[model samples]
Target chain A: MKVTKKTKVIRSPKRGFYDKETIYKILDNHFICQIAFVYEGYPVIIPTIYGRDNNNLYIHGATVSRMLLELEKGVPLSINITQTDGIVLARSAFHHSLNYQSVTIFGEATLVTSENERYKALKIISDQIIPFRWEEVRLPSKKELKATKILKIPIVEASAKIRKEPPSDEKEDYNLSIWAGEIPITSTIQNPISDPKLKEGIPIPESVKKLMKKE
Target chain B: MKVTKKTKVIRSPKRGFYDKETIYKILDNHFICQIAFVYEGYPVIIPTIYGRDNNNLYIHGATVSRMLLELEKGVPLSINITQTDGIVLARSAFHHSLNYQSVTIFGEATLVTSENERYKALKIISDQIIPFRWEEVRLPSKKELKATKILKIPIVEASAKIRKEPPSDEKEDYNLSIWAGEIPITSTIQNPISDPKLKEGIPIPESVKKLMKKE
Candidate 1:
């Protein structure tokens, strides 16, 4: 929403906005985020799983992870989440692009310290992938809870950019006979493959099965 | 790949790496990159389409773009491309992860100078999505070509880290009988939908059709 000296900071420049609904929709659709920050004066981008509860995003990492550890110390960071839906082929190569919905959140992460809040944040993170999985699985132990670091980033300044329609070409180039359109792309999750060492008689939970039917 | 204390930084201690093959594979599978840079002391992250040729990556923007114009002036920047393949669920919620490939290329970008190299880079950028379409479509005209700026960043001091398999949980936790495995995910291109303004007889070229059959 705020334009600085950087413009590429705005993806889908022709169609970009900071609407709350648009930002939430993009965030809910994607679960993975690439968090970028400066490490030792050089840039480092880390891919990690994140869950949003209310306006706060909870990202978890190992207790000793340099990224999470540094984040706990309160450094400014930029997190990006993108979901590609298709390939857009325009008549001109310059106009070619991707049909995608992405959200970029820039904020400083505050470490979650309260025991109760951290526990609920972890549950939210787990339920993000499958809502019912939280109850189906055993809760985390106190020691395990103490070992994990979950950081919360408030979604204050965020934006979404998307391209959904077909290609746009000059009228003169329309008759050139070049193919132009969109190749619909989708991210599909296959049936959950149980681990080889899984215990017998553990029926396939509905939480896990629901993902297979997602389009 | 050299892991400079400044440029090639590792964030995820548990998963980060500076491997050459991993970096190339991550870069090869993706074309769009989210370039992050500090503009006027504030963070800005923008997503844009990009192409890689040899050691340099070519990214273009409008001639009047403030961000791209600043980039052409050798502004410090961080470019990242990530392709998420699947979600990894573990017996323990803390251990949940994602199966993904990403590349973070950091350095000052130099504006491409030679006209021939710019044209060729444009073609490489075009061929990235569809190989045959570059030659099939009309090339950029002199005026259009001159109006765009292409910045190239050498592929140096880059690293890629991946988590591909099922989660590695404690031996005792595995015996707790929770469903744990990878939910395989894939980005597949479906049938192409032609633009409404296209000529009636324009057949879908093989280059466009090839995406649907890609594995």
Candidate 2:
């Protein structure tokens, strides 16, 4: 819950919180993270899936991946994950906003070298994509593990900005004849589609079945 | 859709594209863009709504906003927008992935100077948030315009990566008795909530009603 100068939200003080529990919930709900870093003086952002364990964030890329190489250099970076919940329609356009849950973290990512750590991080990332899928599938082999580069980023400075309430129009605009409210948004997971190349006689795993319903 | 050295996707060449239409479609479908830029020594990213006009990308912030000020400085940056469609459940953990649509662009953002251009950019942004909402509400006053800063970034280099098909497991892994497939995901706009303070005789606007059904 500690706030750092970098993680503080200046514009909307009421909506920002540096609480660890709040930040973690947002991160855990979304698998993808937009990692921003300086690459050759240009700011580059890559959307990659991630997994979380306690305070450590894990991401994997090919050993030769440019993103992984840059992350290993330990340049200070920020990772952001956001989920849009609704469109807040206001009487005035200026007051219009989004009902979203977002978390931004500033940290340093290092290449995970230890085999045990790398193995665990890999499983965590897999499970993050589809909960319990890690144990359902075959683990990585030595060659696969070697070819993959996993990085661990410690959550140092982070903040969550969430706006879930109804629209707050200007006092005078309340008299205007405009419909003002929130059109709620939600992500729905449809039924699972079996892969064409799936082996015959294989039953749909419970893990994949669980994904069909809301988490 | 011009492909520069940095905008190209190298790891999965088959999944990447540099066509203007493809990139624009992805951008148009998503409203939030994760903008990345370097500040001092740290790389920072912020989630902001954006509007596209031909080849120009416009984003607004408070005149004193750190993101806007830094962007106006003309630092090289990348904007990434992504939509996750499904969870690709593979037979092996290493091959697990997400069926996603994403676009990344590299450009230098410069502050809008002319008042006319600023006004138009603001409308484009408003409409981008909710189509046709710009005309429904009052336009910004002179003071409001001056207090806000808008930056335009030319999409000189961009690429889109989209995967919408079923999972592709390893040839040998097809023999495993684990389910291999995709759980399609979709973001749905729920029923609109009328503001508690809405004035009498005010009806729900057509724009808010249109948002109820899919576009």
Candidate 3:
């Protein structure tokens, strides 16, 4: 999809691109996102977990979710996901910036009503956080399903802004006697703590063991 | 400062805190934030870096920043900062969630015009990314300072929402044959990668060296 005026990057047009492939890559790499919507005439930003399946993005919460209630009114919403790759330290304070990849997805969200679809949407969300963990876990009960709400927003319009290179200092500032470089940053999964109320003989799942090794 | 109705955490009131100390700790620990505003009648979210100084929060960008321009007009804005602490893997998909700490501040913003204040704000912003790097880097030139816009938003109405516990699955599901626990997550400062065009003999600063050892 082309970059719509609504989704265009105005501050740094040179850093913007509207390719869905690039957008998906960034979205798949990050599971948490912030959603923007109007609440009582005030713009509000809320942090929540998300899952991307093909062209649609899913976010779930309790049926009493204020975000779900406000968003399902057919109002416009913007979802933002960002990952910091490195810290770019410039020779001048004015030129310091972060090397990051971010995606802004725009769409109107609709509530998923069908029981089958809600289960699928949540399974996608569960697996998004930890691959194959859903298979080992018990499924939701009927009352639990009734209390959960899943909303789907199609990727109708989206754009990505990326900055991967080192800082670009002035020609003269480069000669200054200062250390300038990027301190690489990445998120890692740390040690897992077993639940205090665990049953008698439940071992950590294989899925979690794999994440430990990978991390 | 007390959290007003504007910043109330309605969804999970038990996890909400309005105390300034808790809010400031969350803000100081995380540097990146997402700002929410209305553009062309549609809600928009943009990710940006921020700094916290006492009871005020600061964000800077190019003078041409649409977010800064719109915010300077005294429009309503929502600034959100979040840190993912762990992942709550529940025995049932419906109860799966993340352990995170997030703060949301709501207020009108004003542009910082004085040179002294702008320099201070940028210095605070720079230090927020990496301590002591600003002192080593050259100060911003007159033109560089002129091209940048810094906005200050008071922490008048703010709240921190946090969840750092293990999964709370259904009572019956706890006895089921599934793994349930908390997988920790944290951001570690990696080794600094010297800029390819760095001068010959600029040793890594003590600031970066400390971070390397600590991480």
Per residue, candidate 3 scores C-alpha lDDT tens digits across A72-119 of: 777999999999999998888888888999999889999898888888
Clash totals in order: 3, 0, 0
* Predictions' DockQ, in order: 0.57, 0.82, 0.86
Worst 10 residues of 1 chain A by lDDT: A3-12
Docking quality of model 2: it rates as high
Name the regions of candidate 2 deviating beyond 4 angstroms.
Answer: none
DockQ, cand. 1: 0.57
Tens-digit per-residue lDDT, B1-215, candidate 2: 55778977788888999998899898888789999988888888999999999988999988999888888988888899999999888888888888999999988999899999999999999877788788788667777787889999998989998887877766887778888888888988787888877777777787776666544
Worst 10 residues of 3 chain A by lDDT: A1-10
Candidate 3's docking class is high
True contacts kept of 1: 0.59
- Across B8-30, the per-residue lDDT of candidate 1 in tens digits comes to 44455456677766777677677
Chain B TM (all candidates): 0.93, 0.96, 0.95
Chain A alone, model 1, TM-score?
0.92
The fnat scores of all predictions, in order, read 0.59, 0.93, 0.92
* TM-score (all chains, Cα) for each model: 0.92, 0.97, 0.97
Error of 3 at A87 (Å): 0.7
Cα miss at B114, model 1 (Å)? 0.4
